[model samples]
Target: MKISEELKYTSEHEWAKIDGKAATVGITDYAQDQLGDVVFVELPEVGQMLKQKDEFGVVESVKSVSSLYAPLSGKVTAVNEKLKDNPSIINKDPYGEGWIIKLELPGLEEATHLLSADQYLKALGL
Candidate 1:
């Protein structure tokens, strides 16, 4: 599985890039691969508040539907509107164009608790 060295990850296979007080979030490459071709995505509204690990949305693939969790608490500033039309971008570029949300974080308290790229790989036994 492809993993970005700059991102933090969750045990659930989500990845985050924290920059200043904001973050970009998405499923890992491993996650999209396991899910097969994605058919649909359910995204949260832009103003919604999410806590760490809260179920924020759903991703429906040819194989299964998976719940997306918040890797850190924040106000949702944006969602990937492109996914509504072509969810397969997730499988194509999970760390870039496939990113799911942009969060305006309150602090890094929860961010510090997340897994590093190396730690995440170890958790997956890669």
Candidate 2:
């Protein structure tokens, strides 16, 4: 499993790449691998507010359907519309082109509580 050192993680397998209160979020490499080929993604619209741990969207893969959770409280600033037509990109580049959403964080403090790369790996028993 590929864990990004610069990104913070959630126990549920989401990753948040923070930049000046803006966070680009997505499922971890391990998550996409387990999900198999992604077929659909239901994303939150821009301007939608989300609290930490909130169910923001859903990802349907060949293997299963899973809810996408918010790792931090924020307003959604962007969604990866590209996934709508070609969800398989998630299988191709989960941390790059497959990133699901971007959030405008309410505060940076919320980010601090998320897992580090090592912590996330440990949680996976790696």
Candidate 3:
């Protein structure tokens, strides 16, 4: 499992990469590995306002379907269009090209409450 130190993680297995007041959110590498191969992704439309920890999307895998939660409240600026056609990219590069959405965060401090890479690893009993 690979967790970059620059990102914050939620107990729900979501990651948020902070950039100024904007944040890019996605499922972590550990999450995708556990979920198996992805087949479909249902994402929120651009301009949708979401609350912290809200269910904003869904990821469907060959084994099961899982909810993708938001780590912080914000208005979605964009959704990854590539996933609509190739959901497997999530399993290939979850933290990079596979990122789900970019949001203009409502509260920057919300990210401070999230876990660090080491904390996430410990939470998983790694």
Best-matching candidate per TM-score: 1
Question: Which sections of candidate 3 miss by over 4 Å?
Answer: none
Maximum-lDDT candidate: 1
RMSD of each predicted structure: 0.5, 0.6, 0.7
Error of model 2, residue 115, in angstroms:
0.3
> Could you tally the backbone clashes for each prediction?
0, 0, 0
lDDT of 1 by residue, 52-100 (tens): 9999999999989999999999999999999999999999999999999
How do all models score by TM-score? 0.99, 0.98, 0.98
lDDT at 108, model 2: 96
Across residues 27-109, which tens digit of lDDT does each residue of candidate 3 receive? 99999999999999999999999999889999999999999899999999999999999999999999999999999987778
lDDT by residue for model 2 (36-82), tens: 99999999999999999999999999779999999999999999999
How much lDDT does candidate 1 score?
0.96
Using TM-score as the yardstick, the better of models 1 and 2 is 1
Cα-based lDDT for every prediction: 0.96, 0.94, 0.94
Candidate 1 stretches with Cα past 4 Å from truth are none
